[model samples]
Target: MVASCATCQQKAQQVKAMQTNIDFWPTTLKLKNSSDLICDESLRYLAGKRLVCRGRWQQRTVAVKLFFHPKSAKRHWLREKQGVESLISNQLSTPSLLFAGTLIDGTPVLIFDYLSSAKTALDVWKELDNDEARLDLLQQIVVEISAQHRCGLWQQDLHLGNFLISDNQIYTIDGDGIKSSTDGKELTTKKRRNNLALLLAQLSPNYDHLATPAIEHYAATSQKNMRDLKSITEKELPHIRTTRRHKYVKKAYRNCSEFIRHNSLRQVAIYRRDADAGLIKQFLNNPDQLITDGTILKNGNSATVAQVTIAGDSLAIKRYNIKGIWHILKRCWRPTRAWISWGNAHRLTISGIDTPQPIAILEKRLGPLRTSSYYLCVHENTPSATDYF
Candidate 1:
């Protein structure tokens, strides 16, 4: 027994030393393009605001996520690394982090063991034709959540996309979404129910029939009474919907590629789709010209809306007209109308409500006070609420 204990201690020390080595490993791999990758068989599998490539590393298949934004890359990489390390220490099932480092241009790169045959819960749900299979999957997800709860960890952003299934085993991904209790106590009743509700919210309204059985299974696995669980879930349903609505909206805003520029001339805010400074300046300088050349949608007292196609993309530009000198003074202390509307549009969109996608908000200010503002958004052909009424 003494020899075995000594061996374990020696192994632990070796592991600690190895980790320290890896943490300071020089990060010499500067990934400029996919061509620079060592693995020739690598294919560009996923491309979003960032890039995800599936390739072989160290004789094993791996997934590499490369961040485009330096700041975001550093922040998310650190959070995910911390979460994965915590899960590993607790002996929880998750992907093994093979490597994490920054490239020459300071872009963060994270490599993890790839589950080649795995499918996200969202993907499986679309393929599932029968209700039984769907229910089974939900049960599996609940069991996994219960296990995590028992470990005093809860995923703050629970959704179908975060859960992956392979070989009949469900594995949780998106380590940045995972949260743990610091007090070494079990999750509170409210926290557990909220987490469960978040999972349920991802399902379609038609799948309401599966809620009862799923909840029952979760309660049984968590060793909680079905009646009490049902009561808490019932009371929390409305609040859950509201919370999820806002959460999704915030997520949408974060996902958008946007930037703000300030100079001696004017303040400009631009989104990914409207990075053309010339086009934005044209709309800001010549609103009247656009009204005459472009399609006028609305001519209101306080605002004028026009649809203009710039570079083959249709956009709606709303010019907030200063009603008079009195109106300008009243709004001087507040943010520009364009800024307010841009934020409100995002709020409406994420709340499961319908609204045009806000692309950009530009304000031409004279010193500290605002002089003119313009809100640009994607042109949606949907009818107004008043028309239906």
Candidate 2:
């Protein structure tokens, strides 16, 4: 509605075009974020008003988010929204907060900094060619997420898409899960249960046969990944070796080891940048917060725009590149894709569709375009295990 430059005007016009006749095409067909498009709930909110999907208020490249439905006032939505804004405002390397306001429909709209080099969980697993890199990514995720928990924010949902891996450190993206409480252990247990329920709900009458022992194994391994956050204040993470009584635990460890052997990131060395060190250090010393990876499903695209596949019941990989300001800018230009992909995966997983157990996400900066990448993986898919890396 307001503008001062040519870039602003271009963005405005594009948003206008996207909404005009959105129903004319297939939902599967993707479009540029601009161009006046109506998408999901945002489209419902714009039913009467002719609002455009303009870029963020301060940055020309950031995405514009509008909320038409507001969570209960007593709920944590408002509080978390404020918290996220404050965190990002301090120049924290987390996702940039561009805008937050309530639409006429009462839904809370949130705009965020877009990282172009960012890749989703689906992207990484689909592109992953080996297991070593996958295992390496998983290990880094465990360390980084453990560090986040120490920062006083419990990322309720540790799914893969919630973070971006670049420069050997994980940068959190979604903040809905960030909380004020220091209940890392409790939150981890709840999230694990939530994920399990979601999986079971989507399985068939032969759930056991369909999910296989590997599914339970993956769950136990994921559970162990959160063990480091038990106290959140120890000098170092405690060792969590598999024990006999913990059948699921043993299965989980075996599954993780196998998955890492096939789909890991290889000998790719992680390169950390000086600029990101400050943000990384903030959570490193905290004792109450914990961060976890988003679940990588079987969809999404990559930076090179390469087509990826998690065919069969094997783990997959998806990757992206993030570095300077320009790269982050590119991510803002298109914000709906990740949200959309995430929605689809959640729906499929909840609707009894055969999906994989998303374990870890790998975010790191290597070297050139070929070296920089992101990775997310799953355990198995259907009846048979083809590439269950």
Candidate 3:
């Protein structure tokens, strides 16, 4: 429900108490902008000479987003709500919403606690001179992005500007551009590819040229986020050793630990990244197999492609036809995936058995992919996919 002015005032008070750094209800109480709503001027001084902006509104500090026109308010609201619901339903991490509303002047406003020390990667990039330091920051971002996809959610507009870095970690501020699945499956391949492209573009110095090494680096890290989340939530949670002597005590400890781990991973994945068209292009050569035919998928540019289905309806795949050989290599890093693969392989070897019963490795030097060496293995399911979720 839309919050009332009294509720907004109460929220502002709570935010005042929580934030020892900035006071929203400063003694001065200045309405900094008397002009019509401007995008950059969305932030202004409030009571006690405190600063706040427009975006998502709540009781504490409001996000003064540039609505531009009222005709689009309904669309924006639905998009924002979908994004918020995905994170909240999955128990993923993000800032809680206090309220959303429009000003008397027809300007859109969102109020919530004004976070301290939350800077975007782009904000940090401008401050750094060393290449290594910048790369480290981007790597963390890619990791977070990958985690988000693994959780069956997509950041519809993944970009550096939309992310906020606080306390040595990342947080997402723009919730109006997120996508999700009805059944909560992992993000589609198309989404991953587009996100990688966006990351590459942002990190690259040459706007016109795509960097193969940078793309590869991002892909590797992105894959790592997925693997890490899977291991923690799906793989490790159920295996906690228990003792009969202290059954209740052990059970309680296990439950608590699992909750902490799962939520921690979810927070890392959901709150720190933004996604878009560029990223999807980098991760896949074809993004059409991700959804079903006649299924409406959102597209940033160009027409939305029909979804491809396998085995009638049980499985669906989305594919993208990425252009340029140089572009493809620049966006295919798989470091995180490799690490997880190696770790899994090591664990199986240590157990003196094949992890997937040593499934046959079929050798093939076919298809557009330029790889002559590849292997596939199958494993018995102890706890199936649904069980873990």
Candidate 4:
């Protein structure tokens, strides 16, 4: 028993040490918002509980990303900062990390040297008029990925949006998903092939024609057998797609946030602190009124959806309605659908996949048992899946 106690104490100390190390940042380049700093009037990108803004520091333009989700802020910030540092140490092409630290409110912030002329490979691919040009670009990207593998690193979230084209060179961005092997060995043939296959799978299904030549070029440049590369990629592609879909379905049923629970004679409500307080108040104050008056997008026996404008910003609100007393009793112990959808959306965005930005979730219960729930999210005006096809 004494030995076990000592072991437990040592493990506690190790965890404490790790947390202290993660919270530490060099003070040499710490920034303060003052006359010297100026930010652009509008945001450059906003998704996944984070926002990117253009700003000037020391007269040089920079991109500032603020990660606002408490649950993921520390992990994402550390992964991105460490990944950039690792790539730089290995002499790979990536954005220069200008500064990294936390804001006064404890939000993690990272500043990077801005590339004004850079365009995401997704945008460039959409503009290419011929297959030859597209194939050439794909070959260049494969070469870049090969270089990373040579350095014993691989980006788990390999997607077109993560590749940036500038000055005829392909540069990588969004380093949070990059990983390295734990055994200190060089990347093996299997690992390299899997990485290539994952990258190809992220492209639109319509680009299936480019897979053959792209794999052949990669195998040639990397000095691997073309047939081996083709065989591995063909087997891995379907598995990766199936895994992605399965992950989404699994995560959609889990609660993803710690919500403030409130109960009263009339209803029960739960919300997050980061969410807009005014909106939550309006929602809980009269959920029935909002459901009846808000513009309904869909209405079914199980649920209802509406497009609600609160504080001048449009939001998509989904309300799960109980069909009968039996339904309420069956679901009272399970997580609300609103909570599930919110978690799934956030997970998709953080994985470098596209989804609507989730705002908040509220549940109204009978006594301690949840009977109705509402999920609120930013109403994206982008093209639907059918439109893209």
What TM-score does candidate 3 get on C-alpha atoms? 0.41
Query: How close is each model in CA RMSD to the real structure?
Result: 10.6, 22.5, 23.0, 9.1
Residue 74, candidate 1: Cα error in Å is: 7.9
Tens digits of per-residue lDDT for model 1, 268-322: 4534343566676776567567666789888999889999988887889888889
Model 3 per-residue lDDT tens digits across residues 72-155:
544665567568767767666556655455544433444444566677778897798876776677667766776677787767
On a 0 to 1 TM-score scale, where does candidate 1 land against the true structure? 0.67
Clashing pairs in 1: none
Provide the overall lDDT of each model, using Cα atoms, as 2-decimal numbers. Answer: 0.70, 0.38, 0.43, 0.72
List TM-score per model, in order: 0.67, 0.37, 0.41, 0.61
Better of 1 and 3 by TM-score: 1
Candidate 4 Cα outliers beyond 4 Å, as residue runs: 1-37, 41-52, 65-82, 98-110, 123-136, 180-186, 204-206, 249-287, 294-323, 334-363, 373-389
lDDT at 23, model 4: 43
Error of 1 at 91 (Å): 5.7
Model 4's alpha-carbon lDDT is 0.72
Per-residue lDDT tens digits for candidate 2, residues 53-102, read 33423324454443222123224345547667634643445766655554
Candidate 3, which segments miss by more than 4 Å at Cα?
1-41, 44-68, 101-108, 206-389
